[model samples]
Target: SMICMNHLKVGHYINFGLARGLGSIAYATTAFSLGLLVDKINPSLLVLFFVVGMVLLLVDLYTIEEIAINSDAKTDTHISVFKFIKTYRFYFVILLGFGITFGASAMLSTYLINIVKSLGGTTSFYGIAVFAMAASELPFMAITHTLLKHFKSEQLFVVAGIMYLVRNLLICLAPNLPILILGMLSQGASYGLFTATITYYVSDHIDRKHEMMGQTMISMMSTGLGSFMGNVMGGLLQDCFGLSIMLIAGLIMTLIGSLILVVFSLKQLKTHAS
Candidate 1:
């Protein structure tokens, strides 16, 4: 997914947001269908269904252009990934902020079922919560361009970071199922803003030739490394303190990360002023 995003040279934000929303809708629909079929159909058939879906997906992907042509389409000298990292340290800081946002979100996602159970929610409630959280992305993403018109991507990134903090705080303070579900709905703002803007942010900062590596780096942070750390640390926190405490930890992490971006924004503003 990250690799594909770099190749997109059109209205990138719109394309990204629409794709993400559609993908989330597909995911939610699949979950709902599987829930309905769990009792009526054999589990093994689900594997066949997935294979069919993948084959169809491959057929579609075969139509897309591998490399997008742009003004800077000229080939450049290749550098190893290690050298690229050492050369572009600032990108890593931005990625780390996103990592914290995603890490906290991943922690919530990992233990969502348990959290629902703790709140006296049923299995149906769990499925509904997941659907709502994902489906919430649809409307926000559909209007993402409108959002960008009113707010800079950097400001939106800060909004996303703050929403990440807010979502965790809501979860931490949730006294009942309804409040927790509200927190779940907040994923629209938190997740939507981050996913929609991150690619554009990287595109603006990194060279066109290094597009693939740049997107890959962000993906590794948000989805790969961040998720891994969140799962491990969240489990430890849960074990040591409680699930609620883990949410508090998430709140703090998000705040610190968001603050970094806030400071960065301020510095940029001051530089412009000078």
Candidate 2:
């Protein structure tokens, strides 16, 4: 995705968001089908499925042409991680917001079974909920490029933040399975939009030479560190305090992230205007 976004000349119509949307559809299908398969068959079948998937992925990878970097360009110069961080401190702050919001949102997905049980739902409902959440991402992600025509990426981040805030808040207060499912559906605008915009955001702001680094940094922050923190903290909070307290904590973190994005984005808009 980083390589395609930064290097490939695939034309204006082909974008990271479109690719991500298609991936979401595939994920939704897999999650729903895998749950049914495991319940009806032996769990060990998962290994076979994974092996097949790996083989298919390898075949797909083999078809991709390697992007050549120009040696004469400054793209060859190696920038230290510390140097990259120092130079792009402001962007790093935005990335911090991404990390926090993504973590909070991810906590819900990680502990979704617990949430379903609390609402008197079965494991089947959990599978359905997962399908709903992932499938909902597709439409919003598909139209992200269209949205970009009218709004800046920073502005869309704010919108996505608001969606996260609403989604978490709904989950926190939901009293029934239907309401919970509705909250899950809100992922279309939150995670879906955020994921679609992030690569473009980093590519636009960072230098070409550091584009891959920027993408990696965002992935590390959001998927790696952020997800780890969310899972650990959410579990601790749920065990010690209760599910409600943990959810409220997630909401607060999301709010902070949204505010950070809003404040910094406004500053960026002002700077650009001036």
Candidate 3:
């Protein structure tokens, strides 16, 4: 879904934005139709659909120019992940920051419904909050590359942090349904910015020979370690303290992580100038 963004003439962020926005529309349409069709459709036919989809994806993959052009045909006999990490400590540090940021985001996502309910939101309002966040991604993603042209990726990360800060604060203190939903708008500015750009940044900084490995490490950081920690820590904090305090904790972590990235970005700029 993401790697092919590197191949677009329109630019990675723009390509990703269009891809995700259209994907969201298709997903929503498919989900709604699936809901309606589930009762009438035979279970075995669903498996057939899944197999056909996989086959189509495989065929599509073979047609992508980037896959043909960018991939190595020769297999590596002795690839060492640890040696790569040792050599690219700088990239790892930035990835560490990404992990923390994503961890906090996961915390927010994990408990959003509970926070909404605490603010006196009904089931309908909860649905609205979720829908608004998802729906908002389309337009924001459409403009993400435009925003990137005006700001550094790290600067955009800071913007994402600020949005997240606003979101967590509002969720922590919101007294009514509307305010809580308003906080949900930050989803577009936060994840819509960071998630779309992180891969591009990694690709730019890492050597082409190890590009895929670097991306795998990033995936582990953001989704594997970060998500796991977020789920456990978020749940524990919510259980021990409350949703409000858990969000506050997440806010603090996010700020620290963003600051780390900002420092790294500035350092890179300085090094480049010299």
Candidate 4:
């Protein structure tokens, strides 16, 4: 993310969102293809593909020009993590909101097959649903740059939060395979928008020298930590109470997270204005 921000400098969000959307498409395609290939061919083939992909990525990384900063530029890199967090407490609060909401969304994604099975969907349908979710992201992500022209990143975050809530609500109420797949399509508005804006928001708010830390914090909180919580809690809830209860719990978390984003985002805007 920091690399993209550094290289692009302008229109970073557009390129970032495009890359992320393309990545999702690649994920869906690779996962589905691998599932089929494993059934027909040796599973060991996966390792070869993984190694090839890594090599290609390494080569690609070498092609990008590195942006150099002035030696005398002011930097906060010397600060302790604790001190940094204390200084950027407001941004941390926003990150918390993202973590909670994305956690709920991640839970849905992680357990999508289970949800599909409950609705009598086959693994093929699961693959189709995944594709739908991934493909749906492209158009929304493509338009995010235009959206940014009319709205602040904080404002976009609130909208994304609302979309996350709605997406979860649809999933919770979905009674059939088609409805469940439809709910997955909401990824366009929810995850797509959020991903498009989040790195941009962090980059804009923090010093350029701290961009790497800010981006890392986002990944840790929203994807690493949040996804871990969601996956674990989702499994436990589904095992203990059942799918309905699990969905309800996710929905509740999404609601709380959305409310947090909305309230705090408005406060943030007001502070900036004053």
Candidate 5:
């Protein structure tokens, strides 16, 4: 559906805008739902959120109407859920990426509030932190859109690595509100820049027909997989490693991601030129 809009000759701009808007709305809706569940349920906040997430998964599976890619009503009518997924290596890349990014993110997010309180933060401070973190995304997003015109996935990936490292490094050094806020601001760059660049990269690399699936896969990683991991691990790490250790671990993972990107970018360029 997303790719179909991407390839349209006319109405392209309108279609793309609507598709992105709907995606944003879906995200906003989910965030709102989670907030409401936590606020109203209070004592069973965790259970409420778990059930809500499950409900969302059910909706995704059964609610969204799907049309076969190349439907031939007479004979080419057989298809399975896994059919499209089984055919592409890029699909798996997206899945793995989603796993690493999302899982790690969940662990981090889960601990972030607690960690702040441990470091002398108040409830209002947590709210301030969340707002600051979100506010930082806009500038980085604007920067990405501008740079993407001249750079490629490879460069953006490298920069994202550096940003993540910087954020984690700052956390390890200064576990205070201001520095933490700075680290989170760096997170906006890591999240927005990496995602935007990688999506465009996948769109460019994957076969035209599967671009939308690739896009969806990326979204699933950052939101579904990332959120899950961030919450789970975030709590665990806060209990186990403490804030410093979490920062070190996150820094290492991001560094590894950066190195992999660098190697891949060089290889890709050489392959393309030859």
Candidate 6:
């Protein structure tokens, strides 16, 4: 088992992340279904079901971690949470990305679920819709991999960011479920491309010793900090400005992300030419 773990490729991290996208889709699908179910189910039964699901999830994670330790021959570092914060400013930016992306995405979630539900989706249908999202990744990922062979990764990152900027702006006022799904689908390119490209870039340019740390840096941005910022900002903005404004606010942030990437990317291109 330990030998198999050591045989894993570096790019497995990206694939591992992709695999978790389905988990997210399923989690959100169940949550939305449960939300819709609250009106239909007895309150006590609903609460009992919720508690059982959470407990099972915790148990599952614990079991998995035990297996990981056994198979991977690694131990947890008992580092203080605050020490991670004290590490660097880029990590803070990573955190900011997590918070903003999650916050904004959450604001859109209710709207998205409602849109799908409106478009003849039942609870079971919601699961299918979520599955569709999870499934869309494979094709887009293949195209991204092909593009990587022909283009500088920074350029592709900027391209993905641009597509997201356009997709979300239009999504804010999407007139139907089809359009909403189209916008949501941009995540396939936006998050997917930026992440895969960043991972490859870091692994290719950095020394083998630091590659893992560089990926950890990306994980901090994409999941750790990005999730916090996205969820929080989405909630606050939705509370303050309503759904339309909340969507627009998020659209603006993605646009800014694109702009920042463009600026840095152009500089890199110029440096390479010289």
Candidate 5's C-alpha lDDT?
0.58
Rank all candidate structures by their lDDT, best first, as comma-separated numbers: 2, 4, 1, 3, 5, 6
Angstrom error of the Cα, residue 237, model 3: value is: 2.4
lDDT of 3 by residue, 1-274 (tens): 3356456523432466657766665654554555456668765766776889899999988986563335544666344778778878767777787788778878877787787777766655665676676766677676766777787776676666567667666665678877877777777777666666666666566666676777788788888988998889999998898776787888887777777766786676668779
Per-model C-alpha lDDT, please?
A: 0.77, 0.83, 0.70, 0.83, 0.58, 0.57
Write one digit per residue (lDDT tens) for candidate 6, span 84-198.
4465333334334434444455445545555455555566655555555545554455455467779987687567657667656656767766676677667666665665566
Query: How close to the true structure is residue 243 of candidate 6, measured as C-alpha lDDT?
Result: 59
Q: How do the residues 1-274 of candidate 2 rate in per-residue lDDT, one tens digit apiece?
A: 6766735443434666778888998999987888789889989999999999999999998987776655336456578878988999877877788789888878888998998999999988998999999999988988887888899887887788788888887887789999999999999998899888877777677887787788889888899878998999999999999988888888888889877777887777778889
Error of 4 at 113 (Å): 1.2
Candidate 5, residues 143-187, lDDT tens digits: the string is: 554586787666676667566567655654555778877876776
lDDT of 1 by residue, 17-93 (tens): 77778888988889888878966888887888889999998998898656655565576747677888888865566
Query: How do the predictions measure up, each by TM-score?
Result: 0.87, 0.93, 0.77, 0.92, 0.65, 0.63
Report the C-alpha displacement of residue 128, candidate 6, in angstroms. Answer: 5.0
Clashes of each: 0, 0, 0, 0, 12, 17
Candidate 2 root-mean-square deviation in Å: 1.9
Task: Please estimate how well model 1 matches the true structure, expressed as its whole-model Cα lDDT.
Answer: 0.77
Error of 5 at 155 (Å): 1.8
